[model samples]
Target: MKNEVQVKGKFHYRLIGWKYSIWVRLLLFLLLALIFYMSLYVKLVPQVYDIQLGAVSEKTIYAPRQIENAVATEQAKEDAAKRVQPVYRVVNLKNDALIDAIYDKLLQINVDEEVKFDDKVSIYRRVIPQLISELENQSVKTLRNSGQYNDSLLEQIQQGLAEQQYQLPEEAFFKLPRLTKEDLTAMLPVTKDIVSKLMNDQILDAQTARAKVAELVNTSNLTKNTSRELVTEIVRAVITPNKFFDQKGTDDARGQARESVKPVYINKNDVLVNVGDVITEEIYARLDNLELLKDKANHLPQLGLAILAALLSFVVFMFVRQSTLPITYNNSQLVMLILIFLINVAGMKIISLGQNMDYPYIGYLAPMALGSILITILLDAPLAFISSVLFSLMASIIFNTEHMLLFDFRYGLVSLVICFVAVFTIQRASQRATILKAGLMISFFSMLTITAMMLMEDQFSQKEAIMSLSFAAAGGLLTVVFVIGLLPFFEVAFGILSPLKLVELSNPNHPLLRKLLTETPGTYHHSVMVGNLSEAAAESIGADGLLCRVGSYYHDIGKTKRPSYFIENQTNIENPHDRIDPNLSKSIIVAHPRDGVEMLKDFKMPKPIRDIAEQHHGTTLLHFFYHKAVKQAEEEGADNGIREEDFRYPGPKAQSKEAAIVGIADSVEAAVRSLRNPTLEQIDSMVHKIIKSRLDDGQFNECDLTLKELDTIAKTLNETLLGIFHSRIEYPSELASKKTGT
Candidate 1:
């Protein structure tokens, strides 16, 4: 089951390795874009209309822009309506002519000479009633056309005649009164003048015309109330509305007034309404127009933001692709890069939630530099800088409240400055203290940026600015805290030997190094010598010298398990290999590399160190033991089990330049240490021979080292060895003789 699980794990890693390609990377970018789109879509998009009037606002709302301007646009229409004057058409001319016609008919009746006196009076009353009826019918028709006719006036006249008991063939009257020429003549002038004056003036309705007619007759020259009453009835019928309303003109005036109103604008960040204020219809409509309502599903802005996120993702992809860092091209590194970006964005989003609170500046409290520092430590500082830009942009968007589309550059600028400071300060960090120091520098820069931003603002309270500055400083420190906390997890999980970890491992007080020193001092000294040579060679080739140096320290830890068996640690002791069979000696020699790997693993050392320890020998032959075994078997005439392959170190060869360089340095250091009073020429020859032997044996086949780099390493190692094993001058003979004589 254990073996099966191990096989499964291997297969899983193989599948992951296979799937980690350009397509996977593109998909991850797409996923990142999706994350950004989802996070920012709502913040950027216009919302649905969800607010209700007379309800307490669940959250504080700021005007996206000047909304009162739009409201004033609509209010202008109402003001225009109020400004419009009522339109009227002239009907007074027609009314005046009708009055004159009635008066002329009355005069004709009064001056009649063709009838007897008593018959004239009867004839007059009858003719007068008929004439008035015909005239009233004509006047009503005219008034109707002008929309000013009043049938009620005509009805009142008939009712008044009935009240006086005056009856005629006219069925409208209930009764009629006896009439004389004197009564008719007295009323004729008074009624005509009163009707003419009332009609000539503006009379918008029948009621006003009647009131004027009644008042005129009460003060007229008539002696009897009956005569006055009869005149009022006739005049009231003549007094029709002279002014008719003009619908088209009135509408035009109103429209012009509405057009005259200038729009009122509400400024950005202006409070539209208070927390408990009732949402008026005008306010609601304005909010809707501004796309500030929570329930509105305006999608165009969301689409725009999605496009923006995709564009940013594309930029990130292109940036990574163009990066010179090898990790940028590696599948694992790509995964780590995306993971770091997402984590940073997620943290920004969490911090952004506080932006909705009373103290919106709390968003600056987020540790945006966390990812920047991590990127600087785990990857390259340049990539960290780029990531800082992206993170800052995201922070600005996520925290923006004043406007949906407008970026809050205040937060973005601060984040950028702090992140850059963190990355820059930690660029060459080689110890854990460096990260903390970088964080402090980041905090200092952040405070400066915050102060600059506050001073730039036109309106800011000193208390608020100071508080925000403090939060910004704390944000930087928090970033360091997160970076420190997360660094170990990534290192352990990825088996990455970071510079700080390498430095830590190189300490002499380390348990494995201590053990090697006490148990196998010769091997310990040899390892130290190899570390120095490898570090110098790696530096000459522009490789990771620190890693090379540290890897060399633990490369021969396996030999500590059997110190006496190894020639380096066999001080004042006889050779154990001579007493043992040649096959046993070869087995013991080859076991050291494997033993070192196990010991390193048991101590939970990083993979690079274990790899160097295991691959340094790189399947090279234990030539001395192999030849002894072969000669012994040949003498016995049984060389079947003495193949050269059986006496070789089991190795997968060097996989990195550091490992390969350490391997060469390890061999060179051991060979040079074994030499007695070695000359510079001899040391140079020995270093070249060992390198040539390794090259011929194809030990560097799996590594990426070039022949040119190998040549440099050879030259570097030869020079370093010459310095370590240079010949001593015999100059003290004269001094020694002088001291003896004394």
Candidate 2:
């Protein structure tokens, strides 16, 4: 009874596996059309970052040519020298205004001098007179410039100047509004009042003049020099030659050799060289040469860029075709490509806009790694390979101007090796460890490729090659680190079924399958064999083998609810079908798939595994029960008759790759297992025949599996099934009985 129920499970799975819905194919076709349309509109052309002649760029170098021809007047020069000096204005306690300015104003310099409130006001009062004089001149000039003779404008200007007395001390740094004539005139009347106010307040005592003034005036003019030593610094700025290296006072090393100084003569055949310096005269000559680029001065390689773009685009087209991964409808795939290209553009701009950016080794951090990792993970090997080649070309354009091909090949080769290494290493395992291992492999390969590219150039020294190799190593490490970090984001965002998750479900210890194993061991044993068969078949088709195995494990979990109804869960039981009505028997059996899907959902299985649990049987008729119902009606002379469709399992068919693959493997496994004393020839015939039946029944309607892949899957299943259920030469019934009875 257990064997019969297991056989039934297999039959249902196989029935769904061989279908290919026309709708799925049509959807894929539409997706390709959209992708093709986008890819075509994107023109693949190389850009030469041509620098225009005499374009306004921020020039930092001090040119000797810009020096003034007219010599400065001695008096004016001397005056500027005195004025521009960094003179720290120490607050003289004798001047009240100066002391007030020091305490109230945000000083230009830090000072530690103590100033009495009386002296602060006096000091600022000294500076105010000149400020007011300059303020009135500016206001009158503005009125004259207005070209209006109105007295109101003149009076208003005078009134505005009247308000300037207190604010006169504020400089341009204070952002005070410009003064008018009225402000100045008004201040004139109050100027004496301000002085009187400070005198009454005892804020004026003395005035400490500037050093220039102190030097010019006699000491007798001052009442007393009681000012503290405030370290009033004055900077006499002179554009003198950098005289720090001028050692005229020191004895010359060439002193004695001056009279008998002989120029060092070099013999053409024997030249003495210094240590740590290259002695190549030819190389030294090259250092002094600088190319003066002129716009439209030389022919631009416009056509050359076009040709390169064509070749690259062709390679890209080939790679996209070979992968057989339909990503045109996938928004994630489109977004990834867009992001990668934008990074490439930004990197190119960085390299081109550079004035003294030391590149050829300082690969832009983003494009070098993020692009490669994304291509390898999102796209497959072929697409990654093509992108790597294109990126190599872009790298050369990004890093090189005169020698564009050199850097392009160097980066391109490194990227290809890293991407290739990435795809292969990660194709089997979705674990973090695999990503790290892939990184290590990428590092080695990238280093090797960089080394080869460097040597081929015949230009770089050993040290330079080592630097390039360092860049390659960094790129490899970055690829691994970034992709590994980004994996969880992709998984949750896209509901991705990575290989690692599939592996976890494929484990024999999974709880739902374990319950089946202990409670209904027959079902468990059958599932295990089915898992093995499906895995091999799925692998042959390049559909996830782990997914096939894992899906098969939970496919029959509904059998647990009605253990006795299922043949595999029954133990030495009388046939329940004999006593029960045929309709009841059919209901109990057919409910397993729907019940299993619900149980799988409750256990929180991934959608693909859940899909297999439900979609394994598709909508195929339960022929035995349907025929039994017809027979019962005929025997009992019942007027009512039943449709065969009523006995079918309600289904959407195998709607995805893994679901379809599992369905085929499930059916083939049960059919082959149910045969008692089955020969190798019978197993071979049964598996093929089961697949053919499914294909004819249109069970595999909603998946992307092609006929070629299906054939491959079938062949793989046959091989694995043969190995597991391999026949042995029967010694005899007597030998078999003797061994068993002992």
Candidate 3:
């Protein structure tokens, strides 16, 4: 038998093919660049202003963008340095030694017996001046050479004494009674006690030490006031400041203080100068850093942004090229992907314009989840996940607050989490209602993410937290609304056969399906069985079982156009082909697939369903009609020139796994339905036969089905068919007769 198949014209296919060529690729790249560059231009390039410090501006100059407040940062450093306390070292050891020597000399002079009272007075007066000089010299020497003596304190005390013109009377020194050993010993204890206490304490100045010495002398039980006065003078002369300033340590502490202070930031869009406000030096500097006070040309930031956008676009392109979905390779899909990303970015930008408002967290209201949900529905989850990440990155920057460094991770983090949640929960959405369900998931996740971010900020407030959570939840719902509104548009404009759309088309209430069911019930039942078989077979091979099942349900839609011409729809009626010409019968049989395709197109069904209806028969031969025509031609002894090619249906073959599996299932179901109570063995044999015939005919050549997968499909179809057409056991004859009699 000749295998005749009609070809669908290749004009659109050729056009699509040409779009993937080198020049077309470059044009697509250019288009992407233009879009990205435009999106980023205002953001990256700092808005320039030529106003100088103290200049009256023609218009109000707002801060172009955020930058470091150099002046404020420096002031913070200075304040930190000033807050560092000066360092000091203990230097009290030398003070004790100097006091001891002075005491010994006084004791020696007092104990002497060789001199008269008058001579003793002169000697005491001379010795007293010399001892005071010695004490002063020793203290000053220690202050200069060691860390123990505070020179400033010592000098301060000496200057006070010189200004007072303090002169110990000769009578006070000479009038001291000749002391016994006990007296000298008592004096020694007194001297040692006072000096030790004063030296151990942190004395930065000499006035305190002198005051302590005077208090001690006044409290002492002295025989004479003059003696007490001479002792007080000696004690005051010896006392000095022990705590000395440590310049190196103090400087190091100041350095550390400077290092500890964080650099202050000047927020983006911070008012540089209000309307009619004079420009200050600080405002000028801020504008200069933002490149608003422009004298120098700056293009690096713009170029860098361009490169970043290009890299991001390239990564998205590569991901789509290597993704698991076959539809991603279509140029329309690529265009849609880019357009979706740009639209999401545009939304972010529009919302970001108000980031400077009092409600800083208003950026949380952006519907970033829209992109993830749409991508998940239109494409696959992996692409949706990737798009979610990219959209989050864009959100972080676009929705960034001036207080944030670089990008605001709060927005990015929340967007990423919520978007991923949307993608994960709705990856297999099969109904328009599922989008609403996914929206609820997104809302819950967004609120949760917002709460987490607020808690992390360590600045969570009840009112602000509630506001943020509400906004996030609202944003999620808005995303759902946007997705629901845009989904049908994308489906129609791009001819995307989304799972939701497929589910819609698969409804029995659909016009085409209703027609098939009413006018061609036999074909309808056959299509239903085919759907079951194809679904099972598809699942076995990791194909889209839903698509296969749905495609199978509508695969024989064309049979409804000429319901009586097909055997399945003819039911118990006489065969129409008996009186009709064989060529006419062949023509009717061949016309159905095309007729179904046209009907589907007229109804504006998605392309995948139409394709399945058009390609389910593929190029398989109409063996019965061809053979009957040959036999008649031979019986009549005519030319017998009946061509086998004329008996085949017009076919583009099965172009996808779903379509191919549906085709195989359609044939198997029709073959099995013709049997009278088929046994499991007969069902298995028929299933294998149908699959082998199609495989041998190269019907699966266009799709990606492997040999192993084909075997799996055959085994799966066998099991499904056996279950549907299982043999019933006959009851025993005696049991059947007894039941009937009873």
Candidate 4:
């Protein structure tokens, strides 16, 4: 027997070998990063302007980036700090001691009964002056030691104390001696209480304290005029300004006020100096601070953009590496992904160039969904989802006019909505027109997203809103155009069998499918049954059911060459293999898979369909032919050189879950169809038995199908076959029924 058929295309063969090479993948990722960097280079670098202070008659200048206006922020903070009032601390001044001393002196003078009354009155008057002087001295010392008052404050304190001192009238002094020792004691507490109360309150001056002293004395327990007057005078002399400026506390409060102020920012695209307006020193400084001034070169923006590009590339690379899809690991598929990425980024860059115009919403015109639509059609939906996110991020950056701003939420949001809409709408696309439908869906969703974004703004413009909606709708149509136009190139270049291509191949009018139906109708019917079983089983395990169905349709295209040789097409005809040697029959049986592969390649079918055709038999033995050869050798008592290996189909076993499922379905369909009246139990047993045989033969080793998925496939096939060959209920004979009725 010949070796396994090699049906790989020239381009596929060249790149397929490098799929697993780490160096090749790294280079491909580098290329992706390079595309990102180049596309964003213009937006990343700040635009430089030539202007000087006092210059006039120039075009309007908009801020190229969002930057903190340090000068303005500092000025605002200073203003906030100045708005805070000065903090003051209150001192207690020890008024209780001063009042006690004055009372003790007066009591001492009154107790001198040996002296003349007039002379004692003179002594009381003299002691009153001494006590008042002592009170003033003590207040000055206390105020100085409080650490809150300066020398100027201390002088003010002295002046306030001097003005508050009671002037002792000659009659009042004589009356002071008339008070008894008990009266003096009562008055002492009244004086101390009034002074302490007044000092505890914030006293900025002695005049304020003196005004309240008379009222405080009258309200006290002392009813005698002499005692009240003495208490009032004493209280006034002791009270001085205790509240002083707290420099440290005031500074701290101001500092907090400054800290609480938020920094002022110059928003992106904010007008710096409009046309015909002079560029003052302030305006020139602002431009310099934003790094938009000429002769100021900043490479940080470029370096940052490069880092972002590398990050996006890494995310994509990691996602592809971790994906279980067979095509994800193919170098050709990676190249296709790179090309799609470049095209999308380039479109965004081109659209961003319009930002230089007066229209800021021109970014809405970018066909952001183009890449996602193409990816969903050519690759898996999950991969397309991830690519959509990355594309939105790139669009945000590319469309951003602000050099310092990494992303614009408006662009990112709209791009994300359209990309997701495209992916979901086109995920199950079956026809070429489905791409247009996806575009329309994307367009509708884009308009909704744009409208919602515009409504969120503080200002709304009817004209701008209409323009943005128009751009969004046009963007969707453009996406459809690009997807439809570019799909054929990707399909032919990489030999990827996308869903749309599969749909076209599944058509009955295709040259190969038509030949199978016309030349080998029986085989074609068998293929259709296999397709039904394979599709159901594949769908049960989350595999590509469409690929399985379409692959099954053409899996036996080679049987068209010699339809009578196959049992399915041998309707009412003699078995041709009965006359031929079993070995020759084995060759013919095994040759069909190879012949099918060659026929598929000549027809220029995608690699996956051809792979299904080539691997569906998976080196399975020609059981009937092998056994016949064995029996013939046993009867002749001679060695016929019959090896089980030679009787087997030459196969590179199923390389994917879809191929493995198709193989299992192909076997189970033929077996169940051969049964005359397969009961539900027999059909179920047959499905499990064929699967178990394939498992034991190691046919599923190359694919990722687990034993669990195989069980699921078995269960699905059983149900499908029962539905296909359901039995009807039996009825009694008409003659017996009529006799019983008579």
Candidate 5:
């Protein structure tokens, strides 16, 4: 039976080894890349059409994926630029300085009393022309080096100043000489005030400014008509156009307006043209820019997508290779990971199809947490975290509807939040129902994330917000359904022993456990004690405590075959080992490990449980039967030929930390159980002795049990055993109590 079990176990190992080969791993990665490529192919490389400009449309065309409508975008930019009004800059003409110079010239003429009134008038007129000519020439020279001087600019300046050169008429020249010094002094301030006020305002045309000067002067403090007339003429001569066309400022403003106009998009499934409509230049250009034209098909997007797929596959491959998780070493687990990725991506793709209905929030219903939750429960949480980020990235791309954008960050952010929430909430899941709780957590966080994204938009739509929240909540519930439905398939197909499965196996009502309990109650009780010891010890070293406990429940199942022969189930019956030969008794004792393995295999127990049952004994000698045979041989004075190897159980040794710890716990429990009220010292000594014996025998060499971990296990076992077997106090007898009462 042992040989037969070994051969079957070897066949199983060979099958697993074949799947774990290097070529198989490479092929699995290739398949993963292929799945990514196929899922995104249509979105990346849209269909092209065979239509021409000005031709009658044969069929209605819609955008296959989100793309920027370059023609429409440019037109929008042009419209925005056109809407920007022309910029005008106010030019400082220094009109106050010109008015002050005119007043000073009049003062100088008034001070020259040596001339006749007619000669003074003639002199005033000549000096006014000279001062105006000199000032205008100086103004032109000042603007020449200012970089604003051009032939048209200079011509505009001359035209604007044409009103300023009011030739003092013969009548006005005579009026200016008649004015007294007091009149001239009062007129100076009025003239300056009117010119300054008019220049301070934006004077686009000098003629418009001159028309307002007379009214302003009349309203001033100048009461004399001649003084008012002189001030009006002087103020009018100085007022030129202060506002000019700013060509550079206007161009910059238009450029800014153009830049401020966002690009127009042809969203996925948006109609580009309708049937029976002529293919105008605008529509033809839009199709051509989108690369929808037959001869203008662009393959670069597809190539870029393929490269991205390959890169993602390579990153996953490298991560698995470098990961310390036990499942990462298993090719079957790698295939399962890829399958989970595919399922999540497919879910995103399915939801993305709703984009055609013009529902942009449909991506919120993608069940983004499904893959991370499954991974956290079935595999490792750290692996699930890394995979969650990747899934979010894929979701962003798959659900994108924005023109010319590779990813929609709104979807990515929501997906990332939900995926992380699912992983954290379900990492320690011990039951299938825990997935539902995780889904609720994912849903709550997803709604918050989606709401945050919506609030960031320029405009908020209550209907869209409500739809997104509904989809997010539904997605969480949907994830729970998917996880519950798919978990069993993955567990069964891959022969995985998740925490939920371990919890189920630990139940005492299991068939093998029930058989052990009914047929060999003492051994069943011993196994339970061993499970307690093993679980505490395994947990001390961060091993799988539940696995150790479940394995211990069925470890002694083979004892049910001969309950009477095992001393634990002997009860009041005669000692079967004393009546039988020592050699036969040794054979009976050593056969249990092999028999237990066979029974477990028949029951389809997981490989970890089977390994524990098969390797827990680990070739340790049955000292009682071996010592008894040696004594019998010495007394008979004949060679019994009792080889020490023949008394030991055949084993591959404990192959894992949990198995090693279980073996030590099994030995420690049996040794302590035989003691009559063992003390803490005795229990501590027994636990250390068992562990030390195994360590010295090289039984721990096959596993990764370190000396420090073993010491920790021994301390934990000693503490647990002390709790179980602590001393109890005795109470007084009834006769003594009655004598004391009398």
Candidate 6:
């Protein structure tokens, strides 16, 4: 798979560059967009029913002037009861009884109705015939009884029958016997000239003629007929009730006016609203029947909202495209991105739910986080911040008002901030507990944000404040949980060695470490000293000090296999180095690193530690044996037969910061241990000599160790050695007695 990627891909498996893929950018855009969208959708989609949050403020909802009317209604009922005062006291008909009557009326009225406009004439044809016969009778009666047929008398009967008239769409009016205003105005040119521009082809210049009529068409020149017509059109356009408004829908049952019996503070004479009159869908649709453009404009706000979301998505995608982030997203990220897009589109589509729940504002946090966590863990904090900003803008559309927007912005800002806090604060070496701490921090910030929003909204009514505060707490705590839950999966999937994982592996009881302690106590003790020496040296070089210490602890486990053969374990010992050939002894020493790798493998130690134990010695020739062998071989006349290669350990060299530090510490500790009554000069010399020899042998070639860093390492080793093996004034006799078991 890697070979295929390398052969065909542009920047093949760059441990650093996979995060900047266009796919990642696109996913980020979609994820943020979806979060914005879901903020809208969750409100609408969940119950498929509006959770009516009646007007919290005076501005948003229309109020009825029913207080005085209700009082009058009650007074009228009281007057009737007073008329019956001889028998009973006045009764309250405007309370429970009014509610009951309304409920009964509601049962009788089924608005699940399909209004038929086209079949109107056909359905009412029979009534029309009867109405015509009645009108004929009335006309005959006017002519016969009154001794003359007057248009006025005949009009009275038509007026009486008008209440039974069947109304239909104005388009159908063309098929009726109605007189057109043009017919009357055309016959009356004087009136037409005064109120309208009459096109008379006989006039030469149409423009001049229109200008001439325009002057006469001023308000002063309006004839009674034209004035009446003007008033009619104005009334139809403005004063006529919008059919969509159902006045009943505006009835505030809990308003002060409805308290007890009368709506408080409102003057009865000032009342204009009546029962069964309101702004409803019927009123709007009827007005929509007259104004084509106004109806079309109604949907524009929602459409504008959608466009805003898309624009935000574009901006976010562009930002993500330009970023240099650090996470490598998996297929799941793409899946999450797709999910967000779907949710955003769905949310926006059902934005009517905003009346019940602020989906765009309240709903955005979850999906945004779904993307944000991936971004923080895989990429970087800045990208998550960009994503949050983008998501917030997109959310504005979901919430058409600032109140909804506040909540939406808070969710995004907090989510992004929390993601940064979680990712940047906790390293890979951290563990599950860190996630909880992060959650607490997130919670703190969340509560602060909620408090701020509440104070700003000042609906700081206990209920509202508490509700908002709870949501903030939930969001913060949940973010921590989300991060914690996701860490382990990413660590295993990506083979990431976060700081947390390293810390856990550093435990002394780990199987490999335990084996080294039990099997090679002498080597173990040596390793501990080397660990102390190397950790300080590594820290001075700004290397991973923990890795240095841990590596040194397991560097020489192989020597345990033949403890007697090694000098360190020979207590009260024989002079094996004196008795054995120098070549044999050198071979035994060189073989241990190789043997250590085998032991570590058998113990199932991780590969990195095994490499350190095997490669710490590198390919450096043992100078002591080389000189001795050269002397012996030259004497035997076989000088070329004994190659320097056989004397060296078969090594691949220090391949990391820790390995190199271990090697340096190993040589320094041995040299320092060899000192008898050594002065500070000798310790400094030993540290520098060992480092210079390793540098000359090219042991550090594979490792990234600089000269400046090496110098710091030498100084650190010298100081630490002096401290550990420092000479001191003899203790007093009482402490000395304890030391001697006296």
Query: Could you tell me the C-alpha RMSD of candidate 6 in Å?
Result: 32.0
Identify the runs in model 2 with alpha carbons over 4 angstroms from their true place. 1-324, 328-332, 336-360, 364-377, 400-408, 424-432, 453-467, 508-521, 540-544, 558-564, 572-580, 596-607, 631-636, 655-661, 700-718, 727-742
Models ranked on TM-score? 5, 3, 1, 4, 2, 6
| Cα RMSD to the true fold for all candidates | 35.7, 22.4, 28.0, 28.2, 26.9, 32.0
Candidate 1 local distance difference test against the native? 0.75
lDDT of 6 by residue, 1-742 (tens): 3322321222223332434455655656666655554455322221111111221221222211112235566665555444431211111111122223322322222221352333433433433334334443544354446644234433443343343222333433223222234433332333433323332222222233334443443443345554344322211211111012112222332232334443233321232223334535533333233221131224444555456557766765565446542222333443444443454334333432322222223432232343444444444557655654544444343433343342445554554455455445543324557656666665666567657766787655676556556655665565566556665666565544445555666678887667767766667788899999988988887676877777788788888777767656777878577777878988888988988889877866656678789888888788778888788778878845778888898887887767888998998888777766566778888889989999988888877788888999998988898788877312256456878999
lDDT tens string, model 3, 1-742? 1332222421123243533455656567567767777766665656677686787766766665455667899999999999899887664336566556756765676677766667667776776567656665665665667654345645644554344323565556655545445566666666667767776777767667778887887777765655567667666666665565666668888999999887665555566677776788876766666657657668788888888778877877788667655444356676777678777777777766665434578788888888888888887788888888888877777776553355778888989998998888888788888888888887888888887776777888787888788878788788888888888889888878788888887889988888888888888888889989999999998898998888888888888878898888776789889999888998898898898888888987778888888988888899999999999999999997888778887788887888889998988888877776565667778878988898898888777788899889989987786677655412255456877995
List runs of model 1 lying over 4 Å from the truth. 1-22, 50-296, 324-329, 356-358, 454-460, 633-642, 722-742
Lowest-scoring 10 consecutive residues by lDDT in candidate 4? 5-14
Tell me each candidate's TM-score: 0.63, 0.52, 0.65, 0.63, 0.65, 0.50
| Model 5 ranges with Cα > 4 A deviation | 1-17, 51-291, 727-742
- Residue-level lDDT of model 4, residues 1-742, one tens digit each, is 1432222221122232576556887899999999988887766766677887788937888776565668899999999999999886666666777777877877887788887888877787787778778866877897688776767656655665566566656677777778788998788777777877887788776687789989988888898887888777667667777776666678889999999988776656667878999888888888888777776677788888889889989999889878876455567688888999988888877776666434677888898999998889888899999999999888887787654476788899999988998899999999998998888888899999988887888477788888889989898898888888899999998877888988888999999888998889999999999999999999999998999999999888888878889999998999899999999988888788889999998988888999999999998888999999999999999976778998898997887888889899989989988887566667878999999999999898777798899999999998888777766211235445766995
lDDT of 6 at 245: 17
**lDDT per residue, candidate 2, 626-690, as tens digits?**
88889999999997569877888787688777777777777787777677766656777787788
Judge candidate 2 against the unseen true structure and give its global Cα lDDT, from 0 to 1: 0.54
lDDT of 1 by residue, 586-655 (tens): 8788889899999998999988889889888888988998888778888999945767788888896887
lDDT of each: 0.75, 0.54, 0.75, 0.82, 0.82, 0.53
Q: Residue 589 in candidate 6 has what lDDT?
A: 82
Question: lDDT at 336 for candidate 4?
Answer: 85
For candidate 4, report its TM-score.
0.63
